[model samples]
Target chain A: MTGYIEKKHTFRSWVIEKLFMGKTIKEYLKGLITPFNFVAALILLVGVPVSVYRFTQGIGPSTNLSDNNPWGLWIGFDVLAGVALAAGGFVMGTAVYLFGLKEYHPTVRPAVLTGFLGYFFVVVGLCFDLGRPWRLPYPMFVSVGVTSVLLLVGWHVALYLATQFVEFCPALFEWLGLKNFRKWVIKLTVGATIFGAILSTLHQSALGALFLLTPGKLHPLWYSSFLPVFFLISAIVAGISMVIFESMLSHRVFGNRINHQGVDFDKLTLGLGKAAAIGLFAYFALKWVGVAHDNRWDLLNTPLGHWFLVEVFIFVFFPCLLFTWAVRKSNAALVRFASIITVIGIIINRINVAIVGLNWNLEDRYFPHWMEFAVTITIITVGVLTFRWIVNRMPVLYEHPEYKEIDQ
Target chain B: MEISRRKFLKSISAASGASLVSKSQFAHGAERFTGWPERFGILTDITRCVGCRSCEAACNEINKLPAPKIPFEDQSVFEKIRRTDAQIYTVVNRYPNPKPGGPAVYVKKQCMHCDEPACASACLVKAFKKTQEGPVIYNKDVCIGCRYCMTACPFYVPAYEYDEPFKPEVKKCTMCFERISKDGIPACVEACPMEAMTFGKRSDLIRVARKRVIEQPDIYIDHIYGEHEIGGTSWLYISGVPFEKIGFRMDLGTTPYAELTKGFLGAVPLVLILWPAFLIGVYMFTRRRQEMVETEAENFEIEEDQQ
Candidate 1:
């Protein structure tokens, strides 16, 4: 009876003939670069030149960065904001692999792949913003300033990228039918997950630690010695929120495959929503402690201070409450909406620290130039292309063919 | 299970030693020295400054820096106080109304070499160093140009040579280490015709500043500006007017800037050691559930086969 049911499901899926199943490698490659590839190619064609121009011309000419503000939209939005959004990968990886939650195994590959691509783009964005791109390795090998938060962040990002790459390799191996190689890759899963978590914790917090030294320069409301702790906790919330958001997006975009594969959205969203709720609660408490510890009650009335309050209340506080409500009610749609808001709040908080909060006393604020925008968009576009390319080729978005009949 | 037991034992050992590690982590046994001893330092006396651009002129000459748009003889430079930039390492700004009815106070703006300098602490490559004589200097040869020092500086003194296409370095007042090491005063200090600048031991300069303030309390502000600011700077300022009027950031707290990252820094090793075990434990606990599910599936398959 079980064999009969499996055969029936296979026949249903087999209705769409596998045209590429027996095709030559060359033919497959030729057929693979479709209109989507053309769009991606067009973006790269325009983006590469702009990126080259930025590289040749100094950051001063390429961006609207001023002496008053060292970091601008590129650093704030692209690197900082992008990294926080990518936190979903590590959070989900930990949930399924580290916590042995086999039920979440389906989401793990997609989450890890997203993280890997997100960090890759962050590095690309950093290269564009870096004044001396050639001297980038000096911080890693030559100088190794152990004391600087950037040094810690740089090392962690570098290491974590490698760890994420390793964690995602099994999917590639499985897709290629390299069963022996997949076993070796699977052996690395536990170690890589742990290492990735540690690196993520440090680097996520280190982003906030970068602002700790700028106590007087940064607005009092945002600057705290415990910024690293705050950032780490917020990253937990942000990561869970990102996973929830991405899962919904993926569900919509690949509904045919997901539904055919029997992807469990309800259970996944509930688990992610629970994680987000806890993270948000911790994050809210830490933010309050940051304000109270610093005795910054008077700052709340000022305009910049009011903006900070809004960031905390409207974005952070509201989404947190919404996330909790969604989790209790098992409202996947509400959880999805709250996750998007939570992600936005994380971006706002990062920008506030890296740019908005910086030079708060200055009347003239720094803004990004068109060239800077072009370069940042180019990097993000590249990331999206890479993500699409991987998802198309790897088993990240679907269950393994061998495991399709296995009941959970 | 074997791995878990070993990890549990390792964590127990680590937990037991946590107190010891915490103590050794921050409790730097008291040495009177805040940083490198015998460090080269600069001493600036605000009372002696006469708003002359001689030090500015001398610095340009000695460093072989670019000639200013306005020549040294231009007293009009006093109308606007200037900051150090890519081209200039030191600038003397004129502060009016520091004392009502008194002569306008001339304040030399430069890097205040602190006892525990934040810039040095912040530099990743050890490119910026606090020489034993009290001067915080940068080595361009080893510099990666990360500019962590620029952000860490409380005084906002470190300026990057952003315009330089090839190799840009952090430009700052080095307290004239090259000349001072040879027992010569800084070019700026030596060129002060009004004897506004004094070059001496940081310890001696503080005493000299206090004595001058005591002798003529009516002529100067009672407080010595850098004496205790951010762990006491090498340059001591005795101003006739308030320090804030002259672009001094008085809000910088006394704690050394590196103290801020100490919490996270101390936790790095702890996290490095513990996170792997913690995560693996979670993996094991989860794996057990997966195994149970697999077993249940196997039993269901067997029952279906029997039927």
Candidate 2:
């Protein structure tokens, strides 16, 4: 009886230690009252009800979507921009596991966690946009539209989310102190990485292919047969820049948890900047190639044409030059700054394609309703909170001492 | 000279049975589908229309839609050109006639129902289908209400019940599928006192449109509107004025919209096949290179220790 009691006591202590950061309930509650948490709570308080109201009220009342514009902010920012930013997982996974660049292995766990959460929230955002959210799995199980580009996107996103979870399983297991499970998951890493790459390549491009059927609806300057290629190459840029951008933020926010371990983080940032420069240049060339292929030179002087030029020149070309200069000068701060701009540029590009350039000739244009913004902000807040919670507890920023050698 | 009818029939059946058995699967590996051979179509003669809203009323009644705010006979509704909406599946818009001081041209607008439907290609859940009959029908039971069909449609035909929170559906012209399937003409066609619309097999409709255009060159344009637009639609049109002037887009090419995504979708399986093999190859190569470097470093360290 005494032995069983002692075991129960130890288990309780373990839970308090692991879950509460070795603090008493009162102490943990006090620690949670930080400025960040207060703001997050306030946002959620208002945002959560707005999302509920959306389910009760219907999309028309909550959003500016009309017959002319079916897709809006949820698809533009939440799904497209979210998916692009989350490309860091496949990028880092391929670098560490497939190409055997072990130095980048540290960023893999956080990247995968961010990616997994990002995709999870994308589905959540899609639920808000879909009229029947419960039937999301119908495409996979009930009726499959094999010829559709969206079916490819649906299947790939679902499969890739699972793959990312598997890839990040080691960190999760290590956090839980499950020795045997962590060992088994580590063995599956390379296989999962390869599968992630395959899935990522198809879905990222398939998102672009969704617009191919709207050649007449989308503006001539933005529409092209090479949309899929442009999307894929730019996604690669988004991935690399996102890794740099995320690491910069993570090192600042979670600085105490990360052990430097003599790793040259600045060197890694510059290396990523170099790859991003290459991707941006290729994307820039392809943008003009698309223009020339369509022979839409006359359109370059119109107002919408001017906007397209701004997107191509300021966003794509300028970022290419900035990344190149930053890499050549070995300026890590500049690289980080360039990454911030690149991330914003990717968001702009997605929004332009999904909203601005679509139905350009229409008289009634669509702008997101405030309720739509609230729902979007709510989703992002929840995602960030989830990311923070996992990062704080899991073996993401630092290696667990018990299995340090076994992790690799 | 003494051949019996039964002997001849037996030989003919033996020779043709193999081909007849495979006719249902005739679409397999065909270079292009020319739609269902005997599919029906509607050919509208624009000159014959007199801006009558009877067809609209008939469509509404047959579809069991909510009553319009303005009565069907109210001619004031033509002041503003309108589109199909959640409650309204078809609309009639009045455009300025090409000839100055002439009467306005009233065009009936609804779903074009392309031979290779863009909605069918865009739907992730296969909610929409091109039926063997003329109508491109929708199955609401399987619909997830993504509204991608609204975006994919060239004519901007499909509308969503945005007001219905729980049971939203994509609303569009069914071409009176229930009536057509039961061997009855559409309510709109039956309601038209002007006989402006003709319903028949798609091929016969094309022939009728061609004969009208050739017979009345001065009165009709030298084109059949939907005959070759986006790989031919079930709804054909013959107009006296230029199609562009009456709100029809002439820029839509003859290629089926489904062909646009074919290359990308085709590459999906190719990636699934090739990407893993390539990644594995690279993984093996990198692992071998790393192993070689470690061994070389170990050999050097051993020699130094001996020294």
Candidate 3:
């Protein structure tokens, strides 16, 4: 009995030290009562009950989706936009491991963690939109529809999620003090990154291909045969912009954790901005090419045509110009601003494709219910809380001192 | 009795062996599926259709759907157009006559049951199937309720049970599969007072529709609406007025919707095969370059030390 008690005592102290930062339970609870936590709690308090109401009730009451407009805000903002923004994982991985740009090695962990969390929450958000959420695995294990574009998406997301988890496992193993496991996972990094790039290329373009069947339904101005190419290029821009946007916020929130010696983050930001600028320019020229290809110039005088122009020129072209100026002038703050605009532009483009431009000729329009908005906000908050929790406990933003010499 | 039974079994085996040989001979040279040659279809004569709702009533009764708030006999339902829903599988809309002084034309709308169904191509779970019997059937048992079928259908035929909290299904016209599989006509066709719908083999129905248009060119339009639209729907139609002036959209081209996504799906395997090989090549080049740069820097430092 004494030996067992002593072992238990040692384990308890280790947990308190590692998980709680050597603070008592009371002090740890007190530390979590910040303004941000309080606001997040308030949002959850309203959002959770709303989510429960949605599951118990039917979709008709919870959302504004109809037969004419089957998809709504959940699919547009969560599944489509979420997957596009989460491209940072493969982007950063391929840049560092495959292309041998070792200067980007520091941003890899945070970017992959954000991507894993982003895709994880996208599936969570999809659960609310699916009529039979429990059968989500049916497409994979039960009956595979090989001809479907969605099947490609389903398989890629599942496989890529596993790949990303493997890529981020070194951080997790280091946090748990499993030195042997960390070494094994670090060795698998290049293979996992190559696999991740292949999966990302297929699925990101496949998401755009999902709309190819609806050329008659989607507005002519937005519909083009080059949709898959457009989507792939825009995803690269979104991935790079998200890295810049996320890094800006991470530095402000967790500044002390960064090892500032010899690592110039501002210079990295400028490099990413230059890449994003080039991507946006390509996307902009392609958008006009799409218009010319379809001969939709006559539509520019109409209401929806003007909206498309705003989406292209203001959101896409303006950001391209801003990013170009920022990179040339070496203005990190300006690059951050351009990234925010570009992020918003990606969101707009996705929503326009999935919801707004779809069924444009129809009489009835879909507007999401208040409860739907509540559910979306709740899912995002939970994701943020989980990210913060993991970043606090794991070696994500900083390297563990014991594993300092081991390069992943 | 034992001898007679053995002889019967021998004859049955002999017949089965002959059929198996013939089946292989027929399959020798065919590479592409030209669809079921003997599949049944319906010929819908729009001019003969009255505004009466007997077909709708019969469809609801045969499907055992919940009753509508407004009874089937009410004429006020024609004031606004209606579409197929969870409770109703078919609807008829009245359009103003194109000649200005004639009676209103009533058009019945339902699933076209195309030869190549877009829903079957779009379903990730293989929930939708295009059977050889000429009906695009849905298997709710495997559906994950993604609603992509609703998005893919060119005719907007599929509807969902959004009100059912659990076990919601995509509902559409089954083409009376239970009846038609047993060599019986669909409920709506049997219930038509004017015999507006004629049921026969798809090829025979097309021949009959062509004869009608060729015989009376002025009474019928020069074109059969569904004869070539979206890869030739099983439910063929012949109308007096232009199809576009009525509810039919002339803009949906003759190409099969499934063919639109074929290029993308075909590229998936190519990427799966080639992307890894190309990425590894890039990685090799990058590693070699990095090593060369490191050696160059080391040589420079050694020369500086000697100097």
Candidate 4:
């Protein structure tokens, strides 16, 4: 009887150890680093010095800012473009978890995690460009301008960050093998997911509304009263495209996880392709309407007008048509290419709005300094590192069928 | 369960249709209204300006702004057109020829003090305010040094104190709100040797501007520069030449600058209030159908096992 009791105790301990800690720290680190770390590290080495120079010497010293133009690549590419691209994770999270599309469950964890990290980096990028980042919270607590679009953006970004964190908590719970807590989190997922979706819609549009306040400063071709709506819709397209791009990237970089989970990349890609097509179609129609509403057809004859047409036709129109064709054909490769083009289109649109379109008549335009580029790169490196850290420990890309079976 | 699936599909279709309808309605609604009224403003008359630089001198003295590269008395300063900087709050620029053979034209460079002043609207913190007395003022104490207001300003009036290490703020024309409140003229207006920079109620300024344009049509542009530009600025201008030729933006249109974002801003509350309920309803509708189907499947399995 004594021997049997000892044996039973040892077996129980073994089960606990296996379930609670799937892999040792060393093993987890090895899995996390994957070849991607080297590329991220190389990018960081160049990015760190640039960021330091920006803080010490000021933005004017490092960037091409002038009295005629103030905003540059930092605001245009890193903050605006980066934020739009990250919209994918939230859009996917809403479709799968909130809408109870069980087929999309496998994509939810990674998508939300990506969304969370993407936004986190966007805030970091913004802080770097802000002349006084130390006083950032003044907008949140000390003085609130409820009427301003930026105030809405500031609040929404904060709230959405918290929402994304909650949305991603279940993955962490699963990684820890905390079945009871994980179950509780799963129950709240629907609420958190929906809340995130709502916040994403508001803030993404608010980013565009921030530009609307400068109607005279921005070029007539880009300026529109419907700027917020345009931004919100474009973000939807950007988000879907970003997910497709990231998924393809993950498939290449972390094939082990994809293989382990037996993820149906073909089906996932198809679904995303469909979403991209719909979003692009709507966005294209709106672009035309925006031009029409402003009656800016006369501008098309000028050089600046021609540039606007190029941005719309080559970047927006082409990619949108490509997305539709790729989705209908169920061609994953074609869809992936279209997704990349769509992301490029978003970048072009944002850059045009923030930089190219601003002070169009001025002979001098603001160009970003090397230091600004460095800081942008550094922030991106940090985002990549954070993503690696989360994916390493969390069950973000894997299924824990054992946990589900045990609960049953 | 089958019927519930159909109902869920129907609801989704209806909801999507509603979203489309609302989107079109939003587009129409935005185009209908011009912009908000009761906006702060300023007016400058180019024809009345005499290149005395008294407004520039007074602005520097009152704001405690730093001295300029060129002394106020140096008549040669008129040879080169200058812009406002962190140190200078205002400048008077001279156009060498007003009407090809006429005397030199002088236009003051300061904040336009737009009707829906974009700087005030853009500031995240309530640092910038559109005072009822037709001045857009900045509160440095509340500023976080974001410089978004600088970016948003159509006229690029606000300049950042980038050289300051610990504390920095946006510097711009405040329309002398403190003096105006005390029933005094703005320092610039008071110091103007030619009465070029007029100080009066916005309503009176418009009337004065119209009289000047109507009295001497050849000496002034028929259009008042700020009366309708960007929803009417506090400082109005009447130029002998086209305003565009004399460095004014002609494309600003009559709508208040801030009105551009009104449709989106107004929609924010509506979205905030409605989106959650709309999404939750969809969630519950989907979840309930899933549960009913699961329960039916479970009941069938149990009956089979019992048999």
Candidate 5:
């Protein structure tokens, strides 16, 4: 209202205009009750109650995690996979603000938003899984396990979540029409971005470092001294692929706003696909080197070895080739397909390290109980709803009119 | 998604540039960690063991843990291999004897209480500690029941009390800490009628184990099991049969499990220090490039106005 010539609206009118999309509240709720939203609603309806049950009854009743298998779906998907997927913030922040890639400027905000929401929801999932999650900050404040890799993860994630929030504060400021706060936050962006990158580097690798102590338990195929490096490299692949996958979905779902914003989705997809191809290729090569270094050649004859090969060939190498082909041919459809594969491949890798490859010789392998899946689905649903709610009104999908042409 | 070959090339360079910037430590590392000097430990001779469950009973009674389903005198319980669980800190597992028509050799299984315990290193809150007294003890008050110790332990000694819904703590043998700290023997050692186990300084015990092997090389397999396994566990065993044949993991090399993450953890400070400088340097470099482009555009516009 102050920066633009438009008049200010009362709170009720503003809500009606922005949230209700100038339609009646009844109409807005009717529009929201689509098949997808109905499914999302059902998931949360069952899942939230299951989460409550977990807190009261403990993980024994809710999860299939045993002493033989201490971690299950929640830790693997929510913490490990969630953190890896959220690497987009650091990747895009560096590309746009640090590396002088001005063309990717349109993606930086959304990438950071995606990263912020991903991490926020990861913490939500951790609360459900952690026994006595209220003591989560004990590692940071109360006591210290200086030798542990998990302490590193705990501290880094907490600090990085704050750093990512600060990095995205400019969007929140603009959405709120706080001119001075927005300007100050824009100035803080570079420092916040740098700190976010630093935090990401430590924790991303630290996640893999967590499994280093479980030498014989985690299958030798996935276990190597190179675990931290492999995790870091593959997280880059996850970040790039997720940005592609996310933008594809967001552009289609928020069609009119994206069209109005003039985001060239095709160009961004090809550019991200090219970068992912190179990153995935180097990571693929790293995996082979890891196998050779560990001298696990004979392991390939076994079933576990064949499973490892499937992960490498079909998921890792296949996507690498497809992305390369997609980039070379400028085939957006193939690029999109490869992006999905790359996303799934990253999830597979995290699951491999966290669960499947772990305790490989156990007589009874652990599986996630239905309650565990329900809680996980609930967290994702809430995260998506939050993302949609914010993106609808914030300057994330569209540039702030007053702040236009101000390069971040 | 539009990119000229130049920007595409720039991004290829960027991808490499990003990889170069992270600078991960992925080197293979294997190092032995001999624990504290003068730490008390156990030296058990497997040949003297008669599959007696006296040690198991002593451990359970000393720890005040719940009673086992089968009494300690019930030898039928040993028919199948058993693992130490929440209520039972130690178990006697029967293995095939080296000679024909002989009593199966029994290996007393409990926490190896490794010199550098992986569980202690893995706990996020310092809930577990390798005490100078030679036992790896856990703090019930500090434990958040993450159960990571169970996962990191190569021996799988730490068993979680999953049934304890309110506050669960890992259950494992504490090496009879209460008794040992008082200059008294562990309950198991006291309970052994055959005197199969010896308790003394770990260094002295190792020498004693070595002497037994040297004196009776034929009877002793010539290798002190825990004296070398995983950088020498507290509970040493000199067995007449090969250790592996008696459920011991001969595959566990002398390298301590804690050494596995040494290189990775060593690089933590390096990342914390190097990353911010790298990030800021890139930011300044990019900002300068943007300014240069803008200045050049302004100059061209001025030149056009003059024309």
Candidate 6:
């Protein structure tokens, strides 16, 4: 009875705060008119219409996708690259929850939030790319293709999105000022974390397995039997690097919102950088192992071979070395710079596997049409804006003071 | 509980630096279906092909496809290489015969319809199917139009209706599924004036191809294309010149693409089984520590109250 009354009172109070939060609401609205929002608005302006054009006119007009090249930047960048970029959730969840690293708690909620939003948009982009997006459920509820790697990808991503939502519910409950609901949600933390970790491991690798059927089509340098393993390894670094990278940006952009005294973000960056250094080092070693196992030494002599070297040495290896140097010296700025390169390396690797490295010998290379670029940029812009909105509204970046004991 | 950088590095490497898995030991799970033993198939002898477009015209008429801009009787259509599209399910392309004086060789290309079709394996909705009669058929009602089958097809046979805004589908050769299953031959086979194409049981066709190769070693290539490529296809080819010279990919291995992904899929069950137990154990350990901390905090508060 007391719990019911308390919930009702808090619900009423929450409504009052939203309707008339005094200058707080006005200040947030005023803050939205920055130069950054202008660029985002401009992208949506063009991109929204282009997406509408794609739907009405068909994928032919909006994309450079051909019978020769069925998949383009939308699948390559928006879905594949976006899913990888969102790896921070499982990586941090595993580090803090499973490994018992209490020091990493402050970073956990943001990582989970990033992951949920990232996957949510991957589905959005996937729906756009599909010819009949409405029938997507046929693979799930209607008729399951047991042998399909893509089927595994679809089911696992859907489940993982839900799991991440549940994993982040404590923050949501607190935002709603539902004390009893928040306490109920906190009890589900351990199960949800484990479930998220399992799904993360599967779907992350399943995305790579989606290309396994196209072994002859994907370039020899990229195609390997160990693609799933490689994807999982690189995703770990992608996750760690993304957290280090995102938190650095979050600290700069949302400086006032952060509890700077409580959480020393500089130290956090260096710590995350240390973990990423190890992952990147392993990822580099494994990539060569894939090449050697495939006996692609002859490919190293070709022009694409040189390009592969650039991807490895410059983007992957150099950032790894920089991470080590930064961690050893506790150079937060250099670590931040290395994280940016690591993010770039992840993007290049995904694009290389999906686009450039695929059909490398074909005469006609597929370059995304201008509209394709607009759609991809728009999807990314929407993800960023949504992330900013949640961070501003919810208890994502900082721990809610009311529930400090539980979350902290 | 300060974590030493060296210990953390050791753990990180131990986790992500596990031994690399090689393809040599990997088994593609194609053993589940050895394929219908008595399945019917087509064998094409390129040496006998006359570069006539009668088969193409017959296919267009029988499938009720849109009429071609260049009528089938026009010999000028063979001036350039052509690919099959939504309007046509098959096309014959002329290539210069290896010998200088002989007539130009013509090759008819369509869906290979593998014994274990990759399209069937890749479709998440089970839209593409390999039938008992050997034709790779499709169920349009179940298809989500993801175009993954196009990516999976090594032959690049499947085409899409990019012009259709609302209800597009994957268009490909059905190997005359409607006609062949009903005691009738494919329209293309019946329309072949030179009698270059032969259709029969896959095993019988292989033996027939071997006999032809042995009888005319000088005139035909000893090896039959698609006999073992991608774990054998229903469509077989024999040509006097090298298969590669006429745009055939010699690189597609005998190991079926389905088998290639089985190793990854095989590991999936193990992960799903092991992850929960391991994670829950970790969760228990972490929860125990939290309980201890809570109890210690409670004791400290009681001590303060006594003071």
Q: lDDT at A65 for candidate 6?
A: 87
CA displacement after TM-score superposition, residue B205 of candidate 6 (Å): 1.5
The weakest ten consecutive residues by lDDT in model 5 chain A span A1-10
Question: Which pairs, if any, clash in model 6?
Answer: B28-B259
Give the TM-score comparing model 3 with the true structure, all chains together: 0.95
Residue-level lDDT of model 3, residues A1-408, one tens digit each, is 999999999999988988887898899999999999999999999999888888888788889898878888999999999999999999999999999988888889999998999999999999999999999999999999988999999899989999999999999998888989988889999999999999999999999999999988998888888888888889989999999999999899888777645789999999999999999999999999999999989999999899999999999999999999999999999999999999999999999998889988888888888988999999999999998888878888887788875674
Pairwise DockQ winner, candidates 2 and 3: 2
Count of clashes in candidate 2: 0
Better of 4 and 5 by TM-score: 5
Scoring only the A-chain of each prediction against the true A-chain gives TM-scores of 0.88, 0.98, 0.98, 0.88, 0.95, 0.94
Candidate 5 lDDT, A1-408, residue by residue in tens: 563434434666777876777677888888898888989988988987887788888888888988788889988999899999999988999887778787888888889999999999998888776777778888887789988898888888898889889889998988778889888878877788778888888899999889888877889999988898899989988998999888889878886666335656788889999999899999999999999998989999899899899899999999999999988998988999998998998899899989899988878799899998888888999999999988888888778788887744
- Between candidates 2 and 5, the DockQ winner: 2
Per-model root-mean-square deviation over C-alphas: 9.7, 3.2, 3.2, 11.3, 12.1, 11.7
Please write out the lDDT profile of model 2 over residues A1-408, one tens digit for every residue: 999999999998998888888888889899999999999999999998898888998988989999989999999899988898898899899999999889887878888888899899999999999999999999999999988889889999999999999988988888888989989988999999999999998899888888999999999898999988888888888988888988999999999989748789999999999989898999999999999999999999999999999899898889889989999999999999988888888899999999999998888799999999999999999998898888888889888888776646
What TM-score would candidate 4 get against the native? 0.86
For candidate 5, report its TM-score. 0.92
Fnat, model by model in order, equals 0.47, 0.83, 0.76, 0.61, 0.67, 0.78
Q: Which digits, one per residue and each the tens of the lDDT, describe model 5 over residues B8-119?
A: 9999999999988876576337534467877889988888989888999889888888888998888899788888788888999898886888678988888988899889
Give the TM-score of each candidate.
Answer: 0.87, 0.96, 0.95, 0.86, 0.92, 0.91
Runs of candidate 4 exceeding 4 Å displacement:
A1-39, A177-180, A259-262, A405-408, B1-43, B73-80, B96-98, B295-307
Off by over 4 Å in 6: A1-16, A19-31, B1-32, B285-307
lDDT string, candidate 4, A1-408, tens digits: 999999998776654455334565566456556566778778888887777766776665667765567678888998899889888778887887667776776677777888889888888888776777887898899998766788888888888888888877777777767878878877777778778888899999899888887777788888887788889999999988888888888777666665335557878888888888888888888988989998989999998888888877887788778877877887889989988988998999999999988888777677777677777777877987777666755677776666643422
Interface alpha-carbon RMSD, every candidate: 1.8, 0.7, 0.7, 1.7, 1.2, 1.1
What DockQ does each candidate score versus the true complex, computed on alpha carbons? 0.38, 0.81, 0.76, 0.40, 0.48, 0.53
